[model samples]
Target chain A: MSSPERRTADGLERAQQLVRLKRYEQPDEGYFEGFLKEFQQRQRADLMQRSSRSLFCERLGTYLADFGGRRMLLAGGAACALALLFVRVAPEGQPVDAGFDAPRGEVTPVSAGPLFEGEIDLWEGMVVPAGDEEIDLPLFMVEPFDSRRAAGEPEIIEL
Target chain B: MADVKKRKPDEDRGLVERAKDGDTAAFDELVTKYSPKLYGLVYHMTSNHEDTNDLLQDIFAKAYRSLRRFRGRSAFYTWIYSISVNMTLNFLKKRNRHWKISLDDVDSAIEFDKEFIEQTSKTDPVRESNIHELQLRLNEAMMELSDDHRAVVTMFDIQGMPHNEIAKILKVSPGTVRSRLFYAHRQLQNHLEEFRR
Candidate 1:
């Protein structure tokens, strides 16, 4: 009995012998002549089998792989990112307009009187009126006037 | 010889460039150049004429479609050969083992092969009767191998590819290729022991 390594060597030698026999198996010479035609026919059939959308995508991908198309895609992406960045950062630095930026519904303008001269009673809240008129008003009406003054409105009025 | 070898690839590169530009004629020239060789590779692996024909067609079709992605990192020959091997292995995995082989006629020129002469001289009394049977048994023994082992044998022994070339094609190390060939030869030897007897 041969050692495993020796057996492997002998087997490889014999296998090489048999491999040579495989070369004997050959198609007719005519087969080679017709092979190109057959390949072309099959290629055409393959083309026909492909959907138009896939064909279009294949062509598009090929086009996009070129220098100009790649540059165009990069430029387009950069432009979109810059546009989005401007949109995000623009509103933060914009100046606030009192007339336009203020809330519109269910509110009116108010004004603040001289700060030290206004009454500051403990039981009654600080009373600051637009003018010297000490009109006796309900607490709810006074509350609205205070709220309008806090919101930086120019005058106090009933809605 | 070196000049001849160098010039061939340069010519192939030209054809490949034209084919990339959608020149069907340039591609047809490539098909003409490689089909016979590719046919031999697939046919020996499959042991079936019709299957080899169909597989060869599919391989070329795939190569043509994939030409745009071919970056010339490897020689065109090596690239196409890799494609042929991969597709054939995938095919063998899916194919039924019980399917019958459709071998083409052995060429008359084989009578002149040195190995054939040596084999016939050794088995002269039984050669005439045993040649076809022996060939069939050889193919059966090959089929009995694992797909990976069979690929190594087909590439190394039959196609005469180097270990490094086989490694590149199969994406394995050269050491792995050697081990696979060693094991495959041992298995084939066991399967065909009757011929030795």
Candidate 2:
């Protein structure tokens, strides 16, 4: 029996032999002669298929590379920097409210509920009225105001 | 007496320059010169004539479009061969999972090859009829390899490119190319074991 390395060498040699035989595989006659013409036709078709915009870009890139390799790159960089600076320093087109102290109209306090199960004067530090009887407030009176209503606007009660 | 000729490297360089400058005739000369060689490289990898033809057309078209960037860092031969290998590998990746083995007829001229004669002499006389079958099986075995290994094998074994040339075209070290070839050859041997005897 051949050694492992020797067996491998023999196998590789045989494989190479088989591969050498592959050179005999050739295309039909006149194939090579027509290949150039076919390639030209295909090249034309490809060119026609490409968009004019991409073709322009490709040509422009070639022109720039050939004309000013380093200077053009620096100029492009400077242009981009200037554009960014313009964007950064440009006016936002809106007034700036620096103090945030714009005058708002008077806001009436919204009462949470009766403090002592009866009528209480909210302005007098929760003092219940002396002659008023203890009356149960209606459920509707205790409900939270609808957000859809205008701010600081009092809701009209319908009897 | 026939005149002896020496191929000048500058000939291709001049053609490349002209092609870059939009001379289609010069580019046509390049296409005519390289297409047959590229066809072999692609056809071996694909194992299909129709695919090879379509791929060869696209490869040439791409090379033409990209000729402006051909910076002369490498030989035109090496550069174009690199393009062909890359495009073929990409094509194989996108090819159908159930790729069918389609081989062209093995040229009868191969019978004249010394290796072919010696191998045939050892095999049974009836083995002559099995050439087509053997070719099919070889292609199937080749298809079993990964695209990287297959590329190495196709370039080295079939195209007879030097390991360094394959390495340059593949952008890898010669050591890597040898390793890939070694593994690929082992796989092929196991696959084609029936013919070993």
Candidate 3:
């Protein structure tokens, strides 16, 4: 770092004095007049070439600026307030909302009225019996010519 | 420190109002009023006549486009200076280190300036140096500075703007402006002290 000594200041002061000579560097005479004319031409060309969107915005801005500072401030404040409305702040002690309008449907438990007193039957129709019983045939008495007995007592003849 | 005309805010308000109302004549007045000063500011920064010319044209064009946004929050002087400084700084940033220094002709009127001659007489080396050569060396020394530093130095040293005014233009604190000026002056001294100073 250069110290702030008298000798150092002198050297810098001399250099600074030289730097001041930059003021003499000027464009040729009548440059300002020419600059204005050239600028006017370019300004007209640029404005002519601009899209309607930019022109509208420029017109709107100029209109707004014409409405005075108080109105501008009011408009700015209203915009901020509107922006704040859209920004939902989370309540204290609640987890912040990261979801953006997620689906929300309610759940309902199915009601088949109240329960009755009974063991619940889960296997009611699948049982079968074991086959190990002995069978005796009755002695058959042979009765021949039983056609008349067909109508007697509703015909209970065992075969 | 320069023949650059000072701005008049009261007169500016009327002209700005008129210009805002689509008075091309009033806008022309502003363009005429400010071009030379703005030219000097930008020329010193870029160290190129063509770049300065183009940039000056652009600066005024931008100001003209942005006229509606200019509420009297700051003086037109400060507002336009802000625009020029910002645009030139951006231009310099984009053109970084890829520049060829092209300067304008030193006005012949400088020959008749007694104060400059007197100041040079006080310094043996500066007095002994050729005016054209000294001017070139000075511009080269200026280019050695960073864009930010060069900006403050150009505005403060060459343009003779008050530190507070420069602070306003840069939107930085006055201390920042002063600090930049201090370091810039130091660097310039170092560069020029080897021979020119």
Q: Model 3: clashing residue pairs?
A: none
Best by lDDT: 3
Question: Which candidate number maximizes DockQ?
Answer: 3
For model 1, what TM-score is found for chain B?
0.83
lDDT for model 2 comes to: 0.78
TM-score of chain A of 1: 0.40
What lDDT is reached at residue B33 by model 2? 87
Error of 2 at A125 (Å): 30
How close is chain B to the truth by TM-score, in each candidate? 0.83, 0.85, 0.86
For each candidate, give its TM-score against the true structure: 0.67, 0.70, 0.68
Least well predicted 10-residue stretch by lDDT in candidate 3 chain A: A120-129
Q: Which stretches of candidate 1 lie over 4 Å from their true place?
A: A1-8, A64-159, B1-11, B100-119, B122-129
Fraction of true inter-chain Cα contacts (below 8 Å) kept per model?
0.49, 0.52, 0.72
Per-residue accuracy of model 3 over B1-197 as CA lDDT, tens digit each: 33323545455898998998889899899988889889989988988777898999999998988898788788888899999999999998899576655444334445556676676678767667776667667778888899999999989988898888899899999999989999999899888885444
lDDT of 2 by residue, B1-197 (tens): 01101333355998999999989999898988889889989988888877899999999888987888778888898899999999999999999989776544334444455766566566653265576667777788888999999999888877777787889899999999999998998888888777774
Model 1, B121-160: lDDT tens per residue? 6753336455666677778887888888988887777766
lDDT of 3: 0.79
Pull out the clashing pairs in model 2: none
* Clash-forming residue pairs, model 1: A109-A155, A110-A155, A110-A156
